[model samples]
Target: MNMKWYEVAKIRMKELDINQEKLAEHLDMTKGAISHWLNARREPSLDDIAKIMKYLGFSEFVVNHDGTISTAGGNENVSNLIPYKPGKEYPVLSSVQAGCWAEAIEAYTLDEISEWLESDAHIQGDAFWLKVEGDSMTAPTGQSVPEGNYVLFDTAKEAMNGSLVIAKLTDSNEATFKKLIIDAGQKYLKGLNPAWPMVPVNGNCKIIGVAVEAKMRFL
Candidate 1:
């Protein structure tokens, strides 16, 4: 049989330079439990699997009825990073932390990127990328900002009262995409979907970064 899911996770984790102990913290499990998982002596529960998917950035890899995974296009850009070396920590933000449409979650770089842009607006601070997972912000006319896109972040930009932002509900750590409204007493995180009236995405949601630019694939 192909390597078990746990084993596969172990391999990917190592490739990302993340250790078992660190991954255990993300999974809310003990070190020994992570060991058992890697050894295939233990298995994660359904809820655990979902959390692991989020931690591993595999939210779109659908789980089949047979317990097999279907590798989809969800993690298309997980391979673009140049790999981290010593003395580097990328800012890890949550999606719905920054976006007009696509929310950002994590920064994928080790150093400050102030020199990579064509202008001053491209100066990257403590910001990064979070893979987009939904289409609630898709505009019928703006297919250019396709759903499931990645937005580059800049943590330095102050979140203004009415800017579109990535936010999370304190009740839910999972990130979301929405418009940000600072209404004196209560901040409202507006959703583009009229079906679901805009709520406070900033009040509870963590602000990961302000979007500098969005990256998506046309292919």
Candidate 2:
């Protein structure tokens, strides 16, 4: 069962022994805004929800895809709140095929997926998954993405400067993951590993997607 944000807010207030006015005052928010949130007239942003949950002494809060609130910390049982809808599934592409991921994904049928992965959260936009294939982006400084980890890219999001992105050269048949760097009026795909050569994003280069999140699977 999904609980609305307002219901969760009321329950948390009761559990914390605080009144609505006190909560509104403590959060430095207007009473009407708080009331609006409580009455489901206005939805709070994720940041606002996090602030409210933290103020209420919750350490973990998940904004579920189905517009529900799930809390965990102390004595709260989060298992009941998880929707467990298998989340959003994405296509896992190989290094060679990842270069043309934008085009290749359209040709794939859902039934043909044996090597696919699922998102644990509701990610906005068309997303795709890729397994780290090489150590080109792996560095010894312990800040690099390790090989075999799964990276989720949102094609709908524009690649911003300093964002990790999957890019491919127009003439190449493979895709590579690196930090997108723009310095001195030049764009370059910079890898974490010092051993790997930096590749310039000329007119022949195409960005696939901005890497949003990565997951590690032990099984």
Each model's TM-score?
A: 0.41, 0.58
Model 2, C-alpha of 49: deviation from truth (Å): 3.4
| lDDT (Cα, tens digit) per residue for candidate 1, span 110-196 | 454332211112334665555455555555553233455665556776777755556544564456655567787777765444444
lDDT of 2 by residue, 127-176 (tens): 88877766776788966787878888877778878888888768755567
Off by over 4 Å in 2: 1-47, 50-86, 96-107
Which residue window of length 10 is worst by lDDT in model 1?
A: 113-122
Against the reference, the lDDT scores of all candidates come to 0.53, 0.68
* Worst window of 10 by summed lDDT in candidate 2: 96-105
Query: Pick by lDDT: which candidate is best?
Result: 2
Write out the backbone clash pairs for model 2: none
- Evaluated at residue 139, the lDDT of candidate 1 is 55
